[model samples]
Target chain A: MKQEHIQQIGAAVAAVAEKNRINHFYFVACGGSQAFMMPAQYLFDREIETPASIYSSNEFVHRVPKALGQDSVVITCSHSGNTPETVKATEFAREKGATTIALSNVEDSPLWKAAEYPIHYDWGKEADASDLNKGVLYYLIFSVLHAVSPREKYRKGMEAVAGLNDAIEKVKTQYAGIVKEWGKQYKREKLIYTMGSGANYGEAYSFAICLLMEMQWIHSNAIHSGEYFHGPFEVTDYDVPFIMIKGIGATRPLDERAYDFCRKYSEKLMVVDEMEFDMTGIDDQVREYFAPLLAGAVLRSLADEFAYQRGHDLSVRRYMWRMEY
Target chain B: MKQEHIQQIGAAVAAVAEKNRINHFYFVACGGSQAFMMPAQYLFDREIETPASIYSSNEFVHRVPKALGQDSVVITCSHSGNTPETVKATEFAREKGATTIALSNVEDSPLWKAAEYPIHYDWGKEADASDLNKGVLYYLIFSVLHAVSPREKYRKGMEAVAGLNDAIEKVKTQYAGIVKEWGKQYKREKLIYTMGSGANYGEAYSFAICLLMEMQWIHSNAIHSGEYFHGPFEVTDYDVPFIMIKGIGATRPLDERAYDFCRKYSEKLMVVDEMEFDMTGIDDQVREYFAPLLAGAVLRSLADEFAYQRGHDLSVRRYMWRMEY
Candidate 1:
């Protein structure tokens, strides 16, 4: 991965913050862009006036009213930069006189052209690095956004991302072993339910989509861990795999509750707990910020390995129609 | 069925608005309360900048760090008004020196007592109304809210509710007919999918919940109309009931797309389409808005009649739980 691509992301975010002094930020994108924005949105919402609303471009336009204005900076994220809704929204906001920033892997994508000051990720050459490349781009953008937003937050995010990088190798090794061993058990599973809380909820949905659409080619539902109680929990059978994602911090108790319930009710159960990491040296406050990201990043790695081991063709696009939007 | 009860609801809302001179309004509630808030929220989001955010009481503390402040006025809705998180949140906000208004049916419920101002819909003598009572209470609360909020939209709301009342009657008659004819077909179905957009999306969920927990002991899902395209549309076999809510207005186009697609792909498709009575002299806009309220109000009648026709014991609560703070 190009270190320069990461630096550029950080710089662009910093510049936007300096120019707009964005007290309220709205990150508008869809799919992976929305997923990557979740962690930063949570952090920002915790410190400032509600983490900026993250909207899938179409959702922003159709349901949510005019949230962006002169005081707001809208960030449109797209890997290819040609996402129709995002580009349309960028132009729409510009028409209404709102500032815009585009974040993308391709420099000349339509998103970059539509933006006032587009930041290029240009990590196209390192797409093979997969999660590492995508994660770093988001981390750098988040770092700059933190600096621009509740400026008090920049250092904490920097420290958290750095600590995440340090834990990367161990996370990769641990996940590799787990995926290789347990993935076979998923073959006969009738349905898979992936559940998580906070920042990891998006990741759980991503896993649900990939498993049902890409790996198992079966029906899957990803739910907010708490929401399982409302109805879907009753549908669990002995043949279904209940996957619970457990991270660290205050929300850990809720995930623990979900895990306990899954163990009691689901005959086939799996848990990915991140408490094994020795983040005790890190302050509890910083640990709170890093926990979900590290845990989800690790879980994502395991899911990727599991998909490959199960003979799911990573090169093939099973849900190609997702691109029709 | 008591005209006095309906009048009281309208009067209560007007009184609250006049007393507060409320230029802004906030609605906080979870689950059923949140579901009930959907229609009013869409109306407010369209006409005013009084930004509305919905949160589960437990989540309000964590999710809405900076969304609430001293200058703002909050309205918390709970059917029982005893939901733990909402009560605790009301207390927390009061301690933080913010104003709160609670709306509930129970007279002395914790949430009702905790608010700086509380509006209680004591249909104590009229429990038979069930969900219809909730609608009347909402009509009252929205009228009061619109009168006081920045938009002073009470007149428009009263007019809207009156239109809804007319629609409700027509819907009752038509729904009775639909349930007598179609309710028998639903008995053998294992999976039911409810889909809609905007305000109707929330209604779709309520319908699914009623079908599973109240009407039939079956598995059901309420999906946003747009999201069906993501994956669930592939599951449209003869075994599934693809119920689409086709209301008019902003979400009309999206719902139409779903209706058209379902008609082609699914063998068992049911649609509740917008219908209007002859108001030939009325303005086109009024006629337009009238169509949706007419269509949606009728679903209430259909839901109740369907339950009865299916030989489903509406009195036996399959899912029952207590809310604790």
Candidate 2:
């Protein structure tokens, strides 16, 4: 089942990119889909001139643009493919003269039919969809665009993602231990602050949702590491748990400064990086591009097992999409 | 001093919009700027087929696309106009072949000269620049655009803002009491949640900053009220102080629902709105367009007094752009 869930990394991405050749390239996704697109959007912008706008489907459908051309590709991503906003956005995109693409885990889900081309990424209930490795799905969507655009740097991006499977294997056991430890200590946390920079900001939001929204049932804030100094630093008290996502990326310096600043006011700080951990399985110094996905993968284990160990079923929380009005 | 600060509403907006008749618009604002632009961007896009792209100014100068011959207009709005990003964004826009228009309170400041036209309507220090009544600044920026295009709807928008000012006055003092009550009760609270919809989401960030960074020196989280159901509800215990920015416009239904939801988890639920308070001295609400600005004004008073009563000094907690990095 695990092997079945773990996709052929390159082929999955290449397929998505291949299909993207004809569409207008606008995206409506929520949670992980939106999270993963942060890095991919920049990658597409840096390489090809494809301009993809990512919005929460809930917000998009209510305010659908009238100007989308018939040729526009309105791609929607939802792990469950059952999220109301994603389903509505896909439909709305279709209504507004655009072709819809649904990238989801479930086949024949509502979003699947909403899209002109449904790319079923049958991952099953294996791991957190918001995890950056799963973010590979979003990257794969862009990978489809890159294949047709034919750029060297874009191809290099594909090569970078190719190492994901091997990287996953190398870090699995080590992260399992970390997850076990975190699960043990999860309940004692009063407040959690998740910080990331550049591409990692999306992962920070994912962490906020997965742990705070999914696992520990806690309230957490995701602040860009650069903005930490702007105002968020004042709230850093010794008891607060500050989870800093430090990767060897463009945001390394900012993350370092934030970590250092936290040390002054916070004693309970968890740093997630190769340098901070005992890297028994994973290679030391993963490329910055892949670190976000790796960090997300590592965090999934921490949030899931931690919540489970505390006798909390993910669904027991009974998430309600009920409107207040 | 208070009287000198009250600039005529319509003229202020018209002057700034007139000053910034350029091609592309880059808005440099933090909290309030983000709120106003959330809907304003849609207005600009729908009206002229031009989409307004926002950057935190510092981020824009470094990462935005090349700007030569773009014939751009950079409008930087700050309650105080002392924000570092706004200052830097204005200078950066000027360097890259863009005309700068600064809408700020201070008459002679860095941002004033940074722009081709600086519409200075100095609201005294006591009137929080972050407030919507200070719409004098934001209005000027938006109105300038309205004048250039001469849209009947926008002109009607000005009429609507003028009409709302009286409604705003009827609720001012009541909210002051809400702030006082919240501040007193906040001593026992561990965390504060700032919730809003659409433009209110942007304002929520400022509210969090006010409490977390300025006021009680407590940890706070800003969330879209609509998004609370997907997660965050599990963490909504009695220890949380939920602050809701109640909108009276397009998102009124969502805002009202958000307020009701907070009542369940929040030990103290404070709703900042015109209906909830007696707005006697206030007179700036002319259109529904300025609803965010009005809501912000009430929040500013609450945030300011809350911080002062808690013995927190803004000078010490507030971020300085130069020292941030």
Candidate 3:
């Protein structure tokens, strides 16, 4: 979150990009952490004209792409700084002579020690971890990409990066009441369907899996809106619980179609549209690129409210820390 | 299933490989068909040393990769032969001067007419359309990859292609009884969890979304075994229903880890292990490559039995073909 941290990440990335002729970037992590990296991956692929891939740590270790080499960079994150799969994948990427960057909350953990460049941010459990992680990732990813291809768009985005904290705070404040109400209403739902498309799809996936399923022990499925009608639509009866995160982008129509269909069939439909939130400092032209980050802040409020209404602590787990896998 | 069909597909793929200097491949489709293309995409990335990407048709149309151009090839499939998304994607790919290949059930369908090369197959709805489509894909994909970089391993695999029908039949016969029992036992369960890793992951995804959810109107979630522990595992309890597909591959241990954990917590766990079914004619060394296709045949039997036990016809859909989206 510091200006110095962004400069450090930029310097590290620039050196690697110059030495290795890096053209491909991979963001590797497990579970919710992996989802946090997706918006940056989407930005790199769309805005920077570089190939950016987001991979689950376990899968990346098994099916390491042949395209990865000295000319590639692998960025990994773990809040505890010691997720096994992520540490293993970081090690594997280093073994393949690729540059490895680690983002962790602890400075002395295994993931931090494994990477050539470690971006350590010490944040408390009470803070929204996903929003903090994304804040760092936006700077880390765009810096490296901007260094590779200097453009007016990248420069404009870079100028706006300084105001992201303000923008995120604005989103949280504006959407707090609605988030609390929706979470309270849906707290007892046995099963829920969450839908999104494009960059916001990762946020939708994380909200269902990490927040609802893992934190609250509720059954949830995150369906890509584009693929929703293909099969998942069969479950859309009048009483089905549906939560949709609508973003403004090229994939907006895809989510809109699903939203329209759900309105007709399901009575219990909750939507969090990006257009509803005011990203105060961000320019309208560049708002679509930052939709996921804005949405992540707003969704975290819902997760907190859901935890409160459901009488479940988000940190409590049945098996994750209770026993060894 | 015929030797001549294999040869014809190989010849067509080889010609495209030669003409375009193709180094990138995109498998584009929607829903079950998108899942069908995954194994071929996996094989192309693993064996061919080329960049292979799989995209849902709508996503592909919106975010057509900057890397896609004259040096790229787009392969799509539609069982109904008139999926609007696939037809649009094929047209988009062709506009970008990329070679487009379409596999469809009907010769006169729009999808068939949109492709530069259309591989038409006439198959009844009673047959497992997924298996039939995959059989053609294995030949089409591997042949193009082999032409790009010839190897004895590929040639040996090519020779074994002719015997796939016999291998698939053996799988169906071997697993028939168990499949029927599982269908009968789990017919009343409202929600099911399905997990798979490596190449067979797509089959697990297709089984949950296409067969269980779409056809039977049952609720199911297909979690990647490597990712099962990340969040989905929290939903597991004594009464939870789980159907795990255990495949033999580098990612086998990941599935085994989940299977071991699930057995300890859940009372209801049904496993369809690739090791159980004897792929008679397929060589042991190459067995992992064919795990998905083999698993597909075995799972189709479960879908059939579930339909019978639940007294719901697979073809009866409330919305798919009944209304306009």
Candidate 4:
């Protein structure tokens, strides 16, 4: 997380935008990293007229979109920079004549080698890698998109990115006590359901899968608020545990409906509304678009609290990094 | 599930193809029905050169793709034919001048009224609704794709669809005992992890969310086999129950990697390989394409066993249809 890294990514994005009439932007990565880039994808969808997609690395390799070509740009990430599927996908994008960009902590890794442009940033083990990457991606993606569509809103949004660190700090301080209490109360729960809509969907999903299930070994399922009414709502009971991330957006009504119902039915309902956070200096009109980032920052603190309360090390894993899958 | 129904769907698909030159095909639905159409989406991706996309109903409404237009065909499904989102989406597609097709068990439902071509079938309440919808969707999707692409493989595949009932029956009979044993063994477990890749991913996801989690009130998380190694694999332990569906396809290697890793780490690994079932009369080249349907047929029996073992009626629910959200 350095200013030089941000400048480097901005330069690379501008170069790609100048060189090609980009028809598509694809964000490809493995689980946590892919989830990390989802906010960028949502930004592209909501702000830029150009089409953008987020794909799991393995799926992208198997079904390379027909739209991918010389006019396309593919952004991929791997913190270790040697994740096999991501490296392979970056290579494939290059082979297809699409401009490939790689983001990673390791500069000498295979993913870095495969990219036309590699943005290397060293966020130490203590730092939240996803948050740092999200900051970088917002600058990179919005800059490229702004180059294409030339929107004033895009310029304003980029300016707001500089204040994100301060905004996240305020959010963490405000939610620390509540998060800790939640961690202690739900530490022994066997399973929990998480829900979010629009941009916040990715944060809800990654928090459930990566942090809760993967890091803590606690069972959790993330349900899209829009789809919750269809089937997942049937699982709700007076004692069922539920975590909802309410964000400000066009899809806020969808989340609201779920919240209203859960509050009546489930006694163990926890809602982390982005509106509760003070995102100072960010425009109210564009505040909803930043919900994913804000929610991610707050959820990291909750994950930490859960680790502390449950006496489990977040980095301790039985399989990941310990063995070859 | 009937030959006349297949012929009727084929005729409707041909009519749609004849009326408009479809540049894109979009399959949209909610929950289990959305899962039912994934195989069709896969078929369109693998066979036809035209772009195809699968989307959750709510997401499709929020971000209607720029590619959707007079030349686009949108297919949606809802078993009750009253799913508010799907009905609303079909109306939106019609307003956008895209050809809308609806599949449902209720012929007079709002979804049916909104569709340009409504394909309704009365699969009895006792029958597996998803399996029946899969059978109908296969004919509708392949016929439309074949009309555009004119591939001999598609013709041969259509011919094999005639024998699906027998193929499914064989799979059900073979897996019944094993499914029952699994139900009994894992019935007491608080949470289960399910994994599948390629075409079988939908079945794995739907079985976990729509069946185990929703209908039976059990906790389950479906992990894409390719994504399992990315982060979810960290949760693996000696007692963590896992259900892996191994399908035959280009992505089989992804599942194999996960299966190999889980075998070494977790004691509770249950793999349901499609190769174990006899898909009689299906051509070797097309058998892999039918993995989703085959997996769905087998998993239906497993869901039934779980319902019986848990002493929970499949129709029982705390919310969904029990109370308005």
Question: Rank by DockQ, descending?
Answer: 3, 4, 1, 2
Q: Is candidate 1 or candidate 4 better by TM-score?
A: 4
DockQ of each: 0.30, 0.29, 0.67, 0.49
Off by over 4 Å in 3: A125-131, B1-8, B19-23, B125-131
Which model is ahead, 1 or 4, in terms of lDDT? 4
For model 1 the local lDDT of residue B292 reads 41
lDDT of 2 by residue, A1-325 (tens): 1333234334444444545334335667776566765665544433444344556566566445434556466767887778877898888877776766677777788887787766655463454332333544544643665566765555555445455655665666667776687667656665678988765777888788656654567778887776676567767777778788886665576678788888777777777874443333323332555567778777766777756776776555543544432
- Top DockQ: which candidate number? 3
Best by TM-score: 3
Give the CA lDDT, 0 to 100, for residue A193 in model 2.
Answer: 80
State the lDDT of candidate 3 residue by residue for A104-151, as single tens digits.
878779998898888866475554332366656766666676677776
Isolated chain A TM-score, each model: 0.84, 0.80, 0.94, 0.95
For residue A15, model 4's alpha carbon misses the true position, in angstroms, by 4.7
Question: Every model's Cα RMSD, please?
Answer: 4.5, 5.5, 2.2, 2.7
